[model samples]
Target: MTTPAPQPIDRSGFGTTGKFNVSLSKRYNFDKIFSTAAWVATLFGLVVLAVLLVDILIDGLGRIDWAFLTSFSSRRAAAAGILAPLVGSIWLLVVTALVSFPLGVGAGIYLEEYAKDNWFTRLIEINIANLAAVPSIIYGLLGLQIFVRWLQPITNGRSVLAGALTLSLLILPIIIITTREALRAVPDSLRQAGFALGATRWQVIREHIFPIALPGILTGTILALSRAIGETAPLIVIGAVSYIAFLPELSPKGLQSSFTALPIQIFDWVSRPQTQFHTNAAAGIIILMVVLLIMNASAIYLRNKFQRNRP
Candidate 1:
């Protein structure tokens, strides 16, 4: 007896007796809608940013000549410039980086490579993570109390050093966290191999792990510094003045001198009733943006270069 031939599959459901089945095309309409929505969301931020940039450029382009950069702040809007605030910002950044970078990187190395994994170490890690999320203003308040009031002789109240210290504290958690992450990204096999070769732990970390992690570490540091540069609340809390007609003296005494930053100056300008001051504020914003762009570009360049040079 011959077996009955198997019937052909009706994948198309086109036969008269075939039952209806779901079609894959049913989801296409939903996918199209979601794709369009995502595109709109992405463009929305870019559109807003473009509009802001165009407005600022239109208002401030003519105000950004050399004279604007060199002249001091003036009651007359036409004569007002960013020289004092600009210099103060530079000094603040220098101090902040000098203090924060070494301390942050050292703390990260200790926590990641040296610390015994225990309750105390875990607690410290948790606190650092929490600190990264703390408000900048709180750091400013801490600076005000510790650096300004408590250590008046050293920091001087409302001074560049005070502001720098404040900003440094503000960015320290970020730096530490990023550094740890960078170190952690290095493969464990490298460390093991270094040990297998009879190298010391410090030698392995310093010679092998750190070199491999340097690019990420530097990128994170630059990004953290960028954030510090833009911070206004912490500086304000640390008593940064809105007006300083003279340049900082660039000495220890200068570090203890009263100062203002670009953000503070812009805030002062925008707060004034005069329309020309508003225009000046726009010009200041343009300058601040340019500085930020340069910092970010440098970070990208350095990160890429180091990555390329890595074995």
Candidate 2:
């Protein structure tokens, strides 16, 4: 078994050095080129987005005012306002959050923490991932059949309640996925420590894991809601009217009232031939953008806050 040890390769042989044979200058040049290209692409995207925001501001700045915020849609473009859709959107958001949060977060915790790793769980995970990518219009049609037709008595036939349920279904996958990811982000040692202290699984999750992951969960929720708020096609399919003359009453009955949303109202205005309507549409678009941006900003702030506060 005693044999001669292998000899070291000759470093001075340039031809035998595969990758090492390449000139350092050539590698450096390639890296520089790729880096420059990346920067250019990034800047180009930023420039386009900035141009869009600036244009929207120019077109919509004058149209937004106290009256625009407080009044209702009218036949006259100048008199039309977003109050109905605004209030409806608020109602829809509240109801959607109420319905989706507990269900989604609970499912996530069950799947990630409690559920056994079996074929059934894997199948559910696969389905949940796929469902998150399903076209929203399909969910809308499903909602129309289930919420609008089947549950007409409860939803009052294409009311805010039905629309909220539809959107709740739409965003449930996102929330669940986000929540699981947030839970997964927590260290397993935290769970072990709780177990060492004689705490139950649920208690560990509720007291330790949830508190650590709260910011991420909340951020995901806000982003999901932002997406729901801006959705028009699903709302259209579920009969969210483009024009509603009156606001929903501030009662449980209001959940069953006919409604519209900001996106639907904007879509309606953009469709009209009148220039004033187009201008008003721009204004509505701005308000919707502001809402979405605010939500996104809040998510960023929460995420940063949690990272800063983490021990």
Candidate 3:
């Protein structure tokens, strides 16, 4: 059979010679518009952040010196320092880390590795997620009632320990959620292989799962602690004294000693009508931001190191 002759190509808008003609101006314009919008959105946030940072630095840079770092809060802004609040914040971080890390990680391990998927487990998970979203002030009230009033013998009502406990409660749900996600990321094959090699479940998790998940756990914990560091309302409700002039002793007694934090001190300074105090508040803000940045940098370094070393 002979093949039929090919038909002429349709080129209705062009000359007799077959040539394709197309216009992509509309699509090109749409892409350009979307790209510009995205760029603007990204820069908008960075611009605001830059402006605030510059303003704070300009207001406070001259105030930061050795005296500002060493002296305690005083009526005279020039003589005032962040010694008490800074020490209190450090103590609070230590206590909160000690209280929250083990509990949150253990709970996450049990839920992700041991617990059967039942209604009770589901209910607990749902409640935890909801609690994470609850306002920090609510946790403060809970801590005040339970840790301060109810367990006053130990917490000493409105002490550093009490504040730490409150902050721990506030960050517990976040730690738990982050831990469970990290645990879930571990492959089941690793567990099965360990079991086949005569290792028990506990051994498998202790040796295999924990090391792998540590980076993520650390990152989450640091971020939570950073959030806690900036919290004001919870500490205020739990009675973190705003006018503390002395550092708490670093001993058992210190846990019960009255304390203040950077945020509370900043709030106090900002509330005052004196311009000097406002400048002092800006200095405190700079310190707080530095602390947060350090923590975030640590998190990033740890995450990267672990990711590089992962099998």
Candidate 4:
């Protein structure tokens, strides 16, 4: 015969014979307090951001127009436009995406799936994590020494390509880490199932795992690209000009052309003593935000579409 069920004993708020015990009540209360605190913190952050955004809109909304977007920088604030830097920023985004996406994702896949855990791998992992936290200016200096000077022949010395490569280096570690995290979030059972079905490792990743992880991968890529787009120090260190009178042609040759980006342009404007330039800087900030928003929207759209395409 089955032994009598253990008596529900009150042992300091554990194993109680009630719908809810003291321990559960305490835990529930703790969770409620934590959630309330989190909600308050989130609301505070949103309020601050909203206030800043509203101020920027008021100061800069009138300044943004077709003429402002299409023209080049000029001494007259009314005539100034973001044409050069805008194009340069786009080019940098494209080039940096090209450079970093494959390398970062591939490295992450290899490290997570293929490389056996060892002292060497752990050291590499430690270095990558440390690198992600390094200051942007440090990357600028490194870029100055490597891409701008040592590889000047290949990078065409202070060109958009050089800036893009530098930005790629800046975000590569972040992307790799994010990719690995996304991959790791997949259940181990998926891999086991694939192997049980006689699939190769690569086949498992390609056919079953990668699709599930793709959305997360895209999110990480978006964050990395956003950081690259707003970067100024590296571009400045690599000699991105403040005034590019003309847009670089959209060709392979253009990759090596001198460039500027939104942050660089805004910095130049804000540095000037003229009040109008400061207003223009605000407008530039708005434009930069728009570009970033558009990029993110497109990526999100694509990610959603990819998900919908799946069975």
Candidate 5:
């Protein structure tokens, strides 16, 4: 004999038997409140960012000109330019990249691909995270002590090399952290496949793992460099001069000469009572922003290209 079919419940408050019957309108309204809150918060942050950029553009655009970009600093408003600081900033970037990239990548590889989940590795991991969180100014102080004083013979006291070394320390932890995350993101199956094909551990990391992780590493390095470029306090603490008048050349004498970066130049200009200097400061800011944007864009392009070239 066939069993009788169960009757379907009706919802005119008739056959519904649950203690709580959720009406669609009530549920929709409840969800709407949360969705609105999330969107509002995101939009608020975006609006603030937009306002800041607009304000900067409005204030700084008038200061940019061909002469302003290429001339050296002077006491007179008509003669002062950003040449020295621009050169100094370029030197800082090149040196920092040279010193930081290999060390950071190596550390990342050690941590991600090789380190076991032992107490020592755990401790190292914890310290690296903590170091990343430490205030940048503290790195400045450490740099002042280590690079400026103890290593003065090598860097010649607050020179471009000293500044680069200091900045490297400041960004090293960040680079390593980003690289480790990138390395970790590669699928385990890829590694397993490499091993299954009789590839050595080193070969697997060198050929397969690095190519996949390269994009992420490059992204992180760019971000780290961006942070380094904008840094003023550490450079100040390391005694980067603000009144440099000549472009930094690649010689020992040039290295020993006083230097200034874009931020330092801007700070110097803004601190002056003259309105023209303030305008110059604004110009320097715009230049700095442009350079940073270009660097970030290049990084993104490299990342995309690498991804497309991946096999």
Candidate 6:
């Protein structure tokens, strides 16, 4: 029998380069083609994001001055300020966090840890998924009917409490989903260790699992609130005024008074005839973007901290 020639070593670590390596195949060019395609797609997405950021900065930068940040809304574009809208948005974020976080996190723990993986839990899970996809406008309608009107006896109509509750409901599903994912990421070995050490179920979740998952829960909460902050329809349906001059205070009476958010204020300005008002609206957009970026960054920092601390 004739002896075959030995193949030279392939530097890229594909063993037996003459036969077993897929990248050396003549018929299939998958690796090169797929890698190139993936890189192109990633570059395209980055380019799009860069273009959007550039456009917004170019249009809005000059319009954002001290006066714009500090003044109240008025008929004249120069006189209008974002103070009240900024304060209102801040209040909304605070109240929404306070109201939503505990309820959402608790429900998530119950579902993920306490409940059995039976038909009822599955049904609840499916409904939550469906709720997440429902149009935000539908949540707006629910806020209008249930929070703004039906719960008038409790909240007395169109209050910040109502708005917060509406936003809470909208974001609750997101929180639950994210929290569950975080909980699931906790290694089963950790739970087993805790139990083997004579820990109860509650103790395992409280001491061993929750600390590991807290960062993810916080990330989800920030993301959900970001969504709520950008929303206009729900606030509009619940009767957010477009021309409020004063900042929102936390008291019940304060909440009953008229208010505005950044988006609504921007909308009101952009709808006007003056060119300067449009510029003001663009400035408002920039402000909203900055706030969102800050919130997201803080959440990311929290996530990193937790990940670092996790054992």
- Listed in order, each prediction's TM-score against the native is 0.90, 0.91, 0.89, 0.88, 0.89, 0.87
* Model 4 bad stretches (over 4 Å): 1-10, 13-38
Candidates ranked by TM-score? 2, 1, 5, 3, 4, 6
Residue-wise lDDT of candidate 6 within 195-228, one digit each (tens)? 9999999999989899999998999999999999
Residue-level lDDT tens digits of model 3 in 129-226: 99999999999999999999999998888898899999999999999999999988888899999999999999999999888988999899999999
Q: Which pairs clash inside model 1? A: none
- lDDT tens readout by residue for model 5, 259-291: 889989999999999988887887788899999
Please count the clashing residue pairs in each candidate, in the order shown: 0, 0, 0, 0, 0, 1
Clashing pairs in 6: 71-81
Query: Runs in model 1 with CA error above 4 Å?
Result: 1-35
Clash-forming residue pairs, model 5: none
- Note the Cα lDDT for every prediction shown: 0.91, 0.92, 0.92, 0.91, 0.89, 0.87
Residue 251 error for model 4, in Å? 1.6
- Mind giving the per-residue lDDT tens digits that candidate 1 earns over 224-296? 9999998999888878888677888968889988999999999999999998999999999999988888888
Best by TM-score: 2
Give the true-structure RMSD of model 2.
Answer: 4.1
- Compose the digit string of candidate 4's lDDT tens values, residues 1-311: 89998886676654565745666788999999999999999999999999999998998889999999999999999899999989989999999999999999999999988999999999999999999999998999989899989998988888988898899999999999999998999899999999999999999999988888888888889888998899888888889999989888889898888888999999999999999998999999999999889878977887798778754
TM-score of 3: 0.89
User: Ten consecutive residues with minimal summed lDDT in candidate 6?
Assistant: 19-28
Ranking of candidates on lDDT, top first: 2, 3, 4, 1, 5, 6
